[model samples]
Target: MLNKTIAIIGAGNMGTSLIRGILNAQLTSAKKIYASGTRMEKLEKLKTEFGVHITTNNKDAAKRVDIVVLCVKAAVIRKVLEEMHDVLHKDQFIISIAAGVTTESMEKIVGKNIPIVRSMPNIASTVGLGSTAISFGKYVHEKQHDIAIKIFEAVGDVVVVGEQHLDAVTGLSGSGPAYIYMVIEALIDGGVKMGLPRDISTKLAIQTVLGSAKLVKESNVHPAILRDQVTTPGGTTINAIHELESHGLRSMLIDAVATATIRSRELSELINK
Candidate 1:
């Protein structure tokens, strides 16, 4: 168990998801978690549901925590930082889930050389299968880094990368769920085209994607090699693979990631400005 008090500054979807993930994983006790937000009713509901402390005052929530998680919107991160500035000490750690908000911008606002972590967690976090990548500021120590990793690992997998590479992470895993959803949708439609009912098609497509991913993860095998394993010289799977290759599927996915990365950079520029 992580023996620390954590305050989630926003009681929104991502914040709530992280809170649930933490509690479900038994990382920390509910009483040690403080949730703050603008809506009293929602906060009260959360308090009843999770038995966590809930408050409307951001500073109050922030002042008494080992780690403060910034789960607020990207547009208001600066404002929230300023609001919590006086309360945040160097000993306290910061982990922001706000997309495109760089640690530098956070450092500039906090002005304490505090350890701030910029994290990108996709919407899959809502389901406890999130893919989160964390980038640290200059002041983070080894212990603090481990704490950050442990906190995120409650929700799902966590990877560490240079702060500069976060945009690509944002483009890939951060926005990857939607891309995969599209693929699943297409697969379901294809199954329907082949005379399968919509519901059955949906389930089959979802399981196929999930099982394939599980196989790749468990076997530690390259996807191309795995693809070859399912394919024969003159088989239906090869015929399907030929269609996907002919349609420039790989190239399109590459372009999609690159475009998303560039857009992430542009959004960061706008936010940091």
Candidate 2:
């Protein structure tokens, strides 16, 4: 444990997720964790639920902390940084979870000398199953980078990526959850249409997605290899595969990811302006 005081600048869903993760990892004691936000009730809820320090002033949150997590939305990061800039020290580190917000942009708002770590983490972090991609700023230290990785890894898998790849991570994992969610909804609908009970269909669809993901991780084989293994010369799986292919399912899914990637890159340009 680093034993450093950490402050979270927003108490929203992602902020709460990190708080839960930090508490679960026991990375820092409750007294060392501080949270601030504009919503009084939300901060109260977090204070009561987790027993951490809570406030509404961003600078108050920034003062006396070794590291700060910028959980605010992408649009308002600059405003918040401006609010806290006077109180921010060069020695302190910052970790940001806002999508499409680059480290260089943050440094422009905060200070070029401050250590900043930019990350993209999905909503799954609430359940400790998220995937996070991180990139370093110009002034970040290796020790701070390790600490940021530990903070993210407490919730799920962590990837150290080049700054240029962050937007792709935002496209793939950041918006990817909604894509899988749509697939699950369609699966459940198909099961229900086939006369299965709604509850059972939902459960089956969820488990199928989970199990397939586990297989991809544990089998250590290419997905095509596994696909060939399941395709008997004249099998039911092949028939379904043929139907899906005929309907252009694979191409549509590929296009969806590509579209999301393009949008993520576009957002970067917008944020830069």
Candidate 3:
């Protein structure tokens, strides 16, 4: 928890979620938060819901906060930084959730050796279960890193990783929730094919996924071992596993992560260029 004022430069889903998470966890009070966005309607809604200061001026948001979170899109990170660079100072810490925008790129735009943190947090952050991986800029100190961790912990778990691994993190956890959603949909459809009602199938599939993930987390067991436990010598689950393996399910997921990583690298290269 922190007492310092914080600014979120883009009041979109992630930014809104951070405000909610911070308030829910009592990391900071509502009045200490400032959110900015292009859409007045959305910003007004956020103000009504979270009771935080709202603005259309990014520089105003940056001017007084001890920390500034850049939740804008990667393509607009440079523009946002350039717009607020005059108001930004070294004493303030910067955290950017814009995918593929490195701290080095941000530092270049700011032209100051500011404490910048690059974080990749998945969409699950909206529900306060996000898995976030963070890397630091050249000037970040231990105190700054601890503050960053506490801020992210309000939403979900946090991990410190080398900058080199961030692209892979972007591909895996950053894009992983979508993959799991697709899998859940497929599971629901499979239940429907087997004659279960649509609504019933949906609930069952969702709970099954949720319970399984919780088990893995709480039991601290290897996933393969858990699968083996669920699979008897000749059980229905084993049959399903065979079908999935035969259809290259595992390989498909692997390829998906790899492809995403490659694209992340390409996007980062574009921004750096």
Best by TM-score: 3
Q: How big is the positional error of residue 254 in model 1, measured in Å on the Cα after superposition?
A: 0.7
**Comparing 2 and 3 by lDDT, which wins?**
3
| Residue lDDT tens for model 1, 1-273 | 887899999989999999999999888899999999999999999999999999999999999999999999998898889999999999998999999999999999999988998999999888888999998998899998888898888888999999999999989999999999999999999999999999999999999999999899999999999999999899999999899999999999999999999999999999999
Q: Once model 3 is optimally superposed onto the true structure by TM-score, how far is the C-alpha of residue 46 displaced, in angstroms?
A: 0.9
Task: Give TM per candidate.
Answer: 0.98, 0.97, 0.98
lDDT of 2 by residue, 18-75 (tens): 9999999999977999999998887999988899999999899899699999999999
Off by over 4 Å in 3: none
lDDT digits (tens) for residues 70-153 of candidate 3: 999998999999999998999999999999988998999998888999999989999999999999999999999999999899
- C-alpha RMSD of each candidate structure in angstroms: 1.0, 1.1, 0.8
Candidate 1's TM-score: 0.98
| lDDT by candidate, in order shown | 0.93, 0.91, 0.94
* Deviating ranges (above 4 Å) for candidate 1: none
What's each prediction's clash count? 0, 0, 0
